[model samples]
Target: MIVDKKNDATGVLLRNGHIVLPDKTYVGDLRIRDGVIAETGQLEPEEGERTLDCSGCYVLPGGIETHTHLQLESMGTVTADDFETGTRAALYGGTTTVLDFATQFHGESMAEGLARWHKKAENNCYIDYGFHMALTEWNADLKSEMASIVEGGISSFKIYMAYKNNMMLQEDEIYDALSETKRLGATVGFHCENGLLIDVLVKEAKARGNTSPWYHQWTRPPVFEEEAITRLETVNALLHADHYVVHLSTADGLDAILKARSSGIDVIAETCPQYLLLDNTRYGTEMSEDFEAAKYIMSPPLRDKSHQEPLWDGLACGDIQFVGTDHCS
Candidate 1:
């Protein structure tokens, strides 16, 4: 392809290979100008500044990872990966964008929490990134602050059912937040598990001298997750809320979502590859040490293999619409 001198172009051609376009791929040459795909055709013009000759490799768009926690200050320590290191690793793994969360602290303004997160992330990220507000608490001020966050292009909010002693809100608060988000046309996400039940079980396990990583899964079993999802769904129904369930790890939890969606509640649920592939057994085995245990220790703790097939089926059938990394580094 030839262009006029005024039409300055930097051309790249991936010849004789599949180019995964929006709808389908075709064997052809692709030309770029000013970061936009200028043209696609045979003998694509080479008014080239630079070019990559993809003679036989698959050409695909970069991936988007929606859920990640890097340098996240939670439960008394910062996350293992800082923004620079984590974003570098994400780039190495082919993810070009991340939707990370900005967590609000109790007794602090949401704006301050967002600014804190931004300061931590702004200069360190290598690729594009955005924020989702994680509401550690819901008060009248924070509820009103949600509108400003939406206006600022941060439109998604998250809450938890699990981190009850610290981050989780009560049922009434959850209902209020969900209802407010519905009116604001924002999406709400949840970390759904029963913290109280898990705490009691953990205490009992420790009393029995079962304090290893394996006991982590045993303490906060899958039933707690299932029960939390059911409860959250009921609260959402009462408010007619729109929500996205994040990192759903158990069969029963996903089933509650499936049942809710079938009944016409706008509850969108998702799971990560780790949940589909890993199991609770790891906590007992590989992640038995203190630092190691902390690494694999996440809320909605990993479930056993019995939950795997249903999770995969949910993905295949579109019951689970999105695949996020849940990549907390």
Candidate 2:
């Protein structure tokens, strides 16, 4: 395997078949000392230590999973996976580094929320990690906290337009965050689903006795995502900020991002494997509206099948910047 040499005093050593670095590959032996990779290609074994024979394995860098949500508190409950279990699961999946977002609970200080996440992760992670603060509340104090947070290694910040009645930020609040993150040289991330409009639809659906899991996607269609994306793009433009849209699942949403970029806005979007592989209709009757089907629930819930082609095209043509599992558990 392509091993990191800086992880130990004796470094790393690899031999046998092929190893893939960030770029290029060599078929031979690699030697590392003191944790840094010391040599590569066919090598003679030293007198001390052990040797591993990787005859038919593909040696590559440890995977870096850039998006995940673990132990996040939501809707009067906390998600099942805490940082410990979450990080462990990531390691088990072959991920080496993960970037999870820290949430700012309503009425609590953003700094306090970040500190709490730190305590949850401290001494518990089996791999390297980073944080991106999720701004649910926008105010002068929290906006000002961005500078120090970026200085302290928590640089990226994201705001949601999807978590209506919970985390949706009004236009002014979104602009505040965009401007603040731009000032701090931090990238902004977006969850683009029109909250206000979806709330109306959700209320209407519930009033009509349509409160089922499938109604989740039924109430908030791709049009709402498109509208929210358009709104956020305008705000980001005013701030002259480059931002990332996370887990984009619909063609309309992708088109909004592409159009924004065409207009010269720095709007990078990412898709998740779930969206690429799963469709809304697959939820079936059992996972439809009742019971614990909520277990399969996520914000910006799965979309219809027609969008999959464009999603794949975005990935294949490199219009999408990256793909994440969006795996919380």
Candidate 3:
């Protein structure tokens, strides 16, 4: 049995379920009032309260999705799911909160980008939401706005090492942004892949007339990801700032992060299910012929199956802190 809080204003009482809490788990009763958990542990149904029998269910806290791209414009296209659809899907999956990126384009102000995202999400999201500002360009003016943005509740930021002409920042610009974020006590997330090298590789592939989607994986191999992460490590080693690596896809990149953390650099990372459960073989003959391979074309493209075990081990040992979907939709 289940109670629909949307229809029942009185409240809900759930009985005889496995309640999972931070420190322990037990079979207990839980109550919710006004959409928030009101009590737990052998709770009794109040007068006029709605009740649900949870004989064999695991009641847990709602999830927080740390990475998502909703209603975002990139590479001449916008992602399929806007805030409304995306947040609704998240809620259906038990995720109660989401953090989507509000990206500042190359010539745009950070504030303007933030405003654009707010306009897209306002009164549209089905659950709690927040933004991580993705800064494409760093300048005196943009740096000046960091404090106010942080004050306005956007404390984490993102920078791309890929997407060269459209979103990537120069090494110096990245360094300066890191410096400013460190001073403001904010965190920065990175999309680490060597964009310039990828461009050269892409041109080489096209010149060979290998323009199929399979070439997408071939051109941007794991080495480029390792190289970019190593470069960022060098920068962060000097600054000692708290940083996050998003959608880490390769074993070599994970090794670099492990090395950085061992040396006391405050760096953490996340990998998506695609990296753990899928592999580069998706770009092989069968999928590519149908253009289904296009679905797997993403930055730091999927890696060899050999990389999966190490990533799983990393998660088990706490080397990787979170598993985000990098949910583009």
Best-fitting candidate, measured by lDDT? Answer: 3
lDDT of 1 by residue, 53-87 (tens): 77777667668888988888876888888788888
lDDT of each: 0.80, 0.80, 0.89
Which runs of model 2 end up more than 4 angstroms from their true locations? 1-12, 22-28, 285-293
**Order of quality (lDDT):** 3, 1, 2
In model 3, what lDDT does residue 76 have?
Answer: 86
For residue 116, model 3's alpha carbon misses the true position, in angstroms, by: 0.7
* Total backbone collisions, model 3: 0
Per-residue C-alpha lDDT of model 3 across residues 93-198, encoded as one tens digit per residue = 9998999999888778889999999999998988888999998777899999999999999999999998777788878888898999999999999999999998
What is the alpha-carbon lDDT of model 1 when measured against the actual structure?
Answer: 0.80
The digit string of per-residue lDDT tens for model 2 on 1-329 reads 12334444444456685878767887777676865567677788776645778777666667888788888877678878877788778788778888888888888877888998888788778788888888787788887778888888887887888667678888888887777777778887888888888888888988988776767777788998899999998887787786899989899999999999999887888899888888887555533665556665676888888899999999999899898766665
